[model samples]
Target: MADDAVTTGPEHTDEPVRVGLVGAGPWATMTQAPMLTGGPETRLVGVWARRAEAARELAEPYGVPAFTEYGALLDECEAVAFAVPPDVQARMATEAARAGKAVLLDKPIGLTLAEAAGLAEAIDSAGVVSQLMLSNRYRPRIREFLARAARFDTLGAQARQITRAFVAGPFAFGWRLEYGVLHDVAPHSLDLLDAAVGKIDRVHATGDTRRWVALTLEHTNGAVSQLALTGEVPEGGYTELAMFGPAGELRLDFRDLAGDEADSAAGWATVRREFAAAVRSGRPHALDVHRGLHLQRLIDQALAGLR
Candidate 1:
């Protein structure tokens, strides 16, 4: 067996997996809770947050029990959906895995590579179904975009994620503001480029995370991807990913989506469905904890380049 091996194999069952939400922040309240309840393959069993009131408020609408204790929430579910800050996610997710519950995680899984590595070790030891909530990856449109891109002999790519998230909004504060865009926005673009192009072998970066940062990634397939990211834009920000090759350009623009809420709900629904499938089959997903760790490593490399 390889050193990075996760699960033994698929368990193959048909029952719905009981899932619990771990966080009362905007992400859990707005996206996680609603989607988990609406999905047929998984059941939202309970909610846990550091603050009891927050958990109660988020869980009440779904008719699920709210607990202040993490362990109590874990006991009610076979899977955990996390929407907390990276540091908090790293700690709680590790415990969730140790308790033998699968985890649905957010990107840049941890603030630091060490924290991510520790979580990955726990997942490997527990052999639980683990999947990262790389929201775009779960989107049907984005999946189709990737499928089409796969058909081309991709040579190089460009991606940009610009936002005023840090200037104002619910996400303006907290870990996002404290840690900056490297941990906040870079993960999504990095994951997309890695998926659309090929495995990233090296990264050269410049600028600061708080403002604008640029990265030139060298993929193992010899395709290069350039990224420009920032959360301090003046007005409404834009996002686009374009790949260039002899065949022409393949592009994805975030503005083309119907609406943020509708698009996000669609993505979340797919996430719950896939997570449940992985748990039932006992098969590790392509975007599992290990993929999160891989992205973490790439971010670490980018940080190093900045230094």
Candidate 2:
């Protein structure tokens, strides 16, 4: 293990990991930056972004220096939390991992399978810790539910996410508008489904002009899932994931929960805390880059079917 070992290895120590923030977007400003600054096991030392002015603005309140050069920021910190777009994050995270810096990444690790594979290769080669920010995975309730749900013989599952994210929401990114809900929101649903049920083997999908997408996933464990996603919904749309087995059924209603600011904040805080623990302990998080790649593959399959 090198001095900057990112994954669980001989290089891990009990010292607090120095972390940096990458990307000065809304997500970075609202969640990643604050959580890194306040996390007990991690110190937020620097910030960087493609836009230097945005980086300076974000780093000012924390009294951290904003780096115009991304590599300079990587040099100042042992780990990086990326709040950039999927493509940008994939490129930067690959570089950071190659530099032996641990990475905390956002969902849909990459826009393409090649990018995701490249990131996985970089992380594996560098032996650096990499965690994806799948918000639901960090929720205590969701974790407990998945644990209990996994015990039974999962028969089937259903995940439905209908949101007006593009209509009028904080997640008004151009990518979200262009790609619709499958890329932006389906990753969460798919990740939760994979955790509760099993790995996805194959998928068949169909959708309409309204951006409504329905997918039937065949899980390797003999469990099947129906996932429906759409961004063209009224404000305060519906979101839920239900898994059924011989024992019983378990369902999570994320509609109201996601709309709750306090709950969302708490989820992000837990994500940051767990990420910090991973950096210090060198233990790979449950939602690691490999898992992100798996989800990305599923996303790619679903998108392909849609086309």
All candidates: CA RMSD (Å): 3.5, 4.5
Q: What's the C-alpha lDDT at position 64 in model 2?
A: 94
Please provide, for model 2 over 69-119, each residue's C-alpha lDDT reduced to its tens digit, 9 standing for 90 to 100: 888898899999999889999999999999999999998898888999999
Residues 192-235, candidate 1, lDDT per residue (tens digit)? Answer: 88878888889999999889999999998899989999999969
Residue 185 of model 1: what lDDT?
A: 93
Q: Report residue 63 deviation for candidate 1 (angstroms).
A: 1.4
lDDT of each: 0.86, 0.81
Taking all chains together, each candidate's TM-score versus the true structure is: 0.93, 0.90
What are the runs in model 2 whose C-alpha is more than 4 Å off?
A: 1-14, 208-210, 256-266
Question: Clash number for every model?
Answer: 0, 3
